[model samples]
Target: MSLLSEVERDEERRAGARGDGDVDQPANAQELAAMSKLISGSGLLDVREGELEVQQRNPNSPLHSVKAFEQLNLSPKLIRGIYQMGFMRPSRIQEKALPALVADPPINMIAQSQSGTGKTAAFLLTMLSRVDPNENYCQCLCLAPTFELAKQIGEVCKRMAAYMPEVKIGYATREEKYTRDSYSNHHILIATPGTAQDWVMRYRIINMAKLRVFVLDEADVLIDQQAFRDISVRLSRHLSPGCQILLFSATFEEPVVEFARTVVPEAATIRLKRQELTLDNLLQVFARPASIDIKYQYVTLTFGLFGLAQCMVFCQSRREAEVLQKRLQSDGHDSLVLHGQMEISDRASIIRRYRNSEVRILITTNVLARGIDIAQVNVVINWELPVMRDRSPDFETYLHRIGRAGRFGKKGIGLSFVVDDTDERNLRQIEKHFCTQIHEMNMDDPVQLNELQKKVRK
Candidate 1:
């Protein structure tokens, strides 16, 4: 049976046990209405199948376009670049977002879609399209949270803007090669918030007056941190008055959404439903170890059984990640540890090695969670549950962590470890927050573990 069907059956049994014929209400009114319609005996699987249909039928949405890229009236050079990039047609997000983004009388946009859903290309296209090719100065600025992400975005921008040779691109990360004198000539700039702010204020490297489109690649994560948020707000203040602002992320909580609304006034928004936020193809399961020591043993055994080409093990802290990496190495597993504390060049090199399949296992904190897209990852192990400073479950972090595996319609597995009551409680909270079920697994049973791995590998 499908996973959603299993969840629905479990929910029905619980509702019957409670002696309440009504289904459990969701946390908010919007969710309540959506769930009421979803569980009305039509089946959860049907709702999942029809999610895109429902979204398209929403008359108020700006993302319902059915036109082709050529039909969008883009320049021939830009169209050729897109075709050369191997995109025959626009993805759902591209179809919906491109129309509004490239429209005249420029409008601000706040788009939230799942990872690997063409958000990067969507904004990059906008940035490239907005740049005046004749202008030899910076006209578009894209800010990401990390130098790695900024460099990655810069690479994609370079590829997409290949045919449009006049559109110069610059990287404003710490390792940027441009000197203060030559940095101002690029038409597009991809940077981290801190570096972008310094370039604007201290070095006078970026020409804020000529900036046309300002894009925040990972808006949710960028806005959540106080330091990045302050620097971003300050950077925005220096942009041209008519600069079009665009914010994009895979997930946006209520506070972040509110913040986006405040910063980008009257922006066009494209949001996915909570249920739709989690990729349906991902197989999410958790293992309950009897003790903390057993958790490491279980991971070692499971890694051997799966024989995965590449996997990412997420830890709650850098110290824990380092410790786990050492233990895995001692167990003869080839692994690398990465966190925010490492130098940017080191982090970038490690990511490149991991992406090239030179490293089979990567143990990291949340640094690689949000926007880094590596498609070869077959499994994701949550060595520790994601939580905030107050120790509450961070649902968005969990989503992004697991998202690193099942990318671009690929099947993958997310295995979370529950060591004790606190960890189990946090996992349960995450399951409830996503309105999905995370099946429990018996790590001690080799036969069952093999069967589960087979299913995920298929």
Candidate 2:
């Protein structure tokens, strides 16, 4: 069974064990009697892309099925494009967000889903469905916090528009020049907010007269840095009347939601309480040592023994990333270094080598932890736990780090080395924050170590 289904079963068992009556249950029977009710009192999260239908294991509860493309009533061309992209399935966010987008009097969405849960595709499809190909006035403008993420959205939009004969996609970033004269023929503009905002202020190039949808991909980051006021709302001024706004991110905080509400008045809200696993099919393991030195020793040993599979090691700082890359190379490991401080070309080269499996292990910082897809990454190691304003690493960052390994439900492994009690505390906090149960196996355990060795041999 799928992890979601397993979680549902666990919830059911928990509910059954609670002898308390309706008073203890969060929702009343009438509330639960609708087409479906959420398992954990979180709203029904829609899932698409599979043959599964919404059905109840027992009559007392209602379950919402993940809506497939067939149920979505998407246009033939759109469906063909989605199929061409090899996305024969829709993610839970897409399933839930699409219907809500199409509903008459569109409901605004603020989804907290994992990065690779196909979140980009979900919003892009909605944008495409709402846009008019004939109207080439930047009908939809999607903003991302980082240049990399903006480029990613642009790429996806291009692919989804492949089957659509007339759609044109243009992206503007600090790196790419998309001026008024450059892409006036385009139908959609995917861009970093900083660059897009710069253009709007300079050329007024983005014609809001034809705009219909506005999307903020990494809303939390935008708000966290206090950059949304200058980045997001500046573009909001270019929106046509009654434009539907959507915000999707892996991490959700109260401040970000409040900021969103201020920008989008009269917006309906939906959040996925389950916090969709971005790293599905990933095996997360932690190595605990008596000290930090021992942690490094074990990691190096693991790397040396397993050879390599084009891995990524995440560090907390640019300096640490560089140092780790040097250390690994000195130890006779083929590796590269990347951080936001590096030139864009260097970053790109590192990414290319890593993707092509030319580089065995790439050391980087959080800049690589978001929206960068590397399919050949069979392993990811967190050399140092990320520091967040909160006590734990952002759940989204954790997912994104591990997500590098597994793509399209392929098996992958994420190893986090816990060197001290502080690391253990942080790990526990992360697991608790996400309500995920991660199994702990000792690298020192003879049986477990031997089993792992045997598997590696195969």
Candidate 3:
């Protein structure tokens, strides 16, 4: 069916439900006020105000069984790859998302869950499963927001498909590392939206005719950015009608979710409750600095106060990241900086070094916020608050920033530097939105610092 027809049918289905007494009831003033606070504070849209929605296009799908990975009846090579990766059982999101993802007749999906929840692996498995190993062309296309993230996803795909020698994976970013000829023959391609569009329109490098699966790893971020959003929509139009589109993210604003629905109509959606959005294993804390200069001092002090294996310092702008990196380095602390303005190759190299533990502290902008997983990062320092262009508190960015740490069930720490009343208000809003408290640290008192170190060590 055409995209328009599919969307119309979905609207008709929803309309029929409304006719059958399934209409959305209006929220009273108090409820509306609470919801408004939640969205504004959390930077996350509460889908229907605290309700978690899960929809499956095919309710009676045989693949809905949440059994062992072996029970999914996947290929031996793919199964061997799974076991080789040391995955004994599926994660919650994986179990819920995989069946529909790997089911036959190819259905679209929209899945949301907390970070470090195996969402990447879930979609990677589907991409690997759906590929025709015998065929030698780009069958699966995965798009990420940043080059670092795209490279990380490509690495994961290579590892997961290690046992399957026939699955060729390619990464298309601004860097000319992967040649056009190499990309054309790749069985699976992971790329940034701009580069992907360029390859399709200008270079004519990517052939979308036989594309089977199109996965958007950070769907919310991609849809929010205007440049990426426009190119992504154009690329989707070029793909064959039967291609499966899968959208995955840690958080989805309500409007972005709606835009995704329109883009991929008849998609199955999996969303988590508001309470389930925050990572429980991550210990969140805030340090109120007397001045902006003191904020830098506190970051330096944190290094000595805790057993930090590695940490990422998040700055609001490129200038902040650069200045902080220079200051930290001058203080004899080893650090590196990453931002959008840097060369793609340099950013990729910095990410590689950070992942390898060559650099202990990596100061960066929002580039590293979403899906780059570094297991050794024990702490995340918000050098500056994440705010939107209008200077509103960015709760979604906060979640992604803290999410960089505490990956894969490991304990992590998130520390934000609040220097003024504005910062304090934003922090409080985040706490209220999540319905969780961020332990306050008194940097003036050594005893409080010691107590925080003890908690972090635990």
Candidate 4:
């Protein structure tokens, strides 16, 4: 059947399923029994096509089952630390790995799990489990690919250490001053790989004789850059005997697996895979046009009308990101631009504004796609396709872009404009990967345009 015909039939089926009885009728015993019988007789009463019915079937409802924490034969100090953070239950990943790390002889671990799955606390608890309050040398180290992520991991460490006395956690950045002695006295050192490497070479301050815990967060990004191997090599040269290493990231790509083998040779591996990580909270829609220029025009028009709390536009290059941001601002969109070429402080400030709702829209490259958490963002627009190693647009990048929205139990929308044969191929790849149907939202159709206008007006 044609797409329009299918949509129409679905709508008709829904209207018919409502039945002749008054929906607002009070539920007396007889009325309730009749309604139950009617629904049980036809699957139409249970199956729904809209967002509301799908939410009714959500497996991740707030009142959903809270997975219990495994009984790790942890010491009194570590149990006290976990309680200090007010964490009573473990996420799925945490439940599986905590006991293994706390056992008689700690085993190194490498985990491939999606973001927002509590990877931070899983590793933090393990690190805290190994820490000795009496020792002053850096005993645990967690390295992140970005300064922002390093700072976030440091904050998590602080929260976990609230009840523990005299335990210090520190992070380093070129923009910030951190004394070598300050880090020398820390029990946990959370740092960016670059900053950590700098400290290793400059101050030679890391006393690795007592260090026993090491973690690499977002391992895929570092694997892609070969920074994972470089950092692992440098760290191995300084690590104490019997040190335990952990590698964590969203995707279990092949390169990441190889890097993990070298870093944690006999480490236990865990994977959540793509199926579990795909966000069900997003409503994905595509807009197809006769040409790229028309696609650009439609994007400009739609974002102008959408008063979203926060929106991100993903482009292919620094030039494209800048030009698009300037054009949108000229059209009175008041958007900010971000990319690798900008200064560090400037990028952080733009992110702060977008996070705080000071700016409604941001245009940038893929750097912001991972490890940066902004819950208020509700819309993501793909202005340009992500290029893969084969020099073609990749579907995985598209998934990550759309995944940014509808996070943490909130509804989100993802819109993309496909304008050429190449774009069509990219769309097919996306559909095939998810086994999902991507509805094409026709901008030229008067009915759709009117509906969009009505939504924006409200």
Candidate number of the best lDDT: 3
The Cα error of candidate 2 at residue 187, in Å, is: 2.0
The residue-level lDDT of candidate 3 at 382 comes to 88
Tens-place lDDT digits, model 2, residues 1-458? 11124555455345435632111111211121110111112222343435222221233533333457767757889888988887776666565556766554555666665444667788898888887877667778888777766776787788888888787788867897555678776778888777777766777777655677888876766765667556687667666657888876544567666767666655545564433446556767777676555666666766754446667888765655676677778878778887766555555556656666777778887777754556677778888666453335566678777777777555667888666666788888877876665656686677886776555445
The global C-alpha lDDT for each of the candidates, from Candidate 1 onward, is 0.74, 0.65, 0.74, 0.66
Which portions of model 3 show Cα errors greater than 4 Å? 1-53, 59-63, 276-458
Could you tell me every candidate's TM-score relative to the true structure? 0.56, 0.52, 0.54, 0.53
- Which portions of model 1 miss their true places by more than 4 Å? 1-64, 177-181, 203-205, 276-458
TM-score of 2: 0.52
Candidate 3, 105-222: lDDT as tens digits: 8879988754356677788999999998788788999988878678777887898898889888888888747666777788898999988988888888787767899988776667
The TM-score of candidate 3 is 0.54
**Clash number by candidate, in order:** 1, 3, 0, 0
Looking at model 2, the pairs that clash are: 47-66, 49-89, 49-90
Instruction: State candidate 1's TM-score.
Output: 0.56
Q: Candidate 1 — what's its lDDT?
A: 0.74
For candidate 4, lDDT tens digit of each residue in 1-458? 11124555455335435542111111222222222222222111211112111111123422222245436765566666766666767766565666666654777778865444567888988888888878878888888776766776788788877776677777766656877766677888887777777776778767555578888887776655566459756775677658888888655667777777777766766675233335576767788767655766777666655456778888755556777788778878889998766555566667767776888889887666544547777778887556553436566667777778766566666787776777778887878878887768887787876775454334
Ranking by TM-score: 1, 3, 4, 2
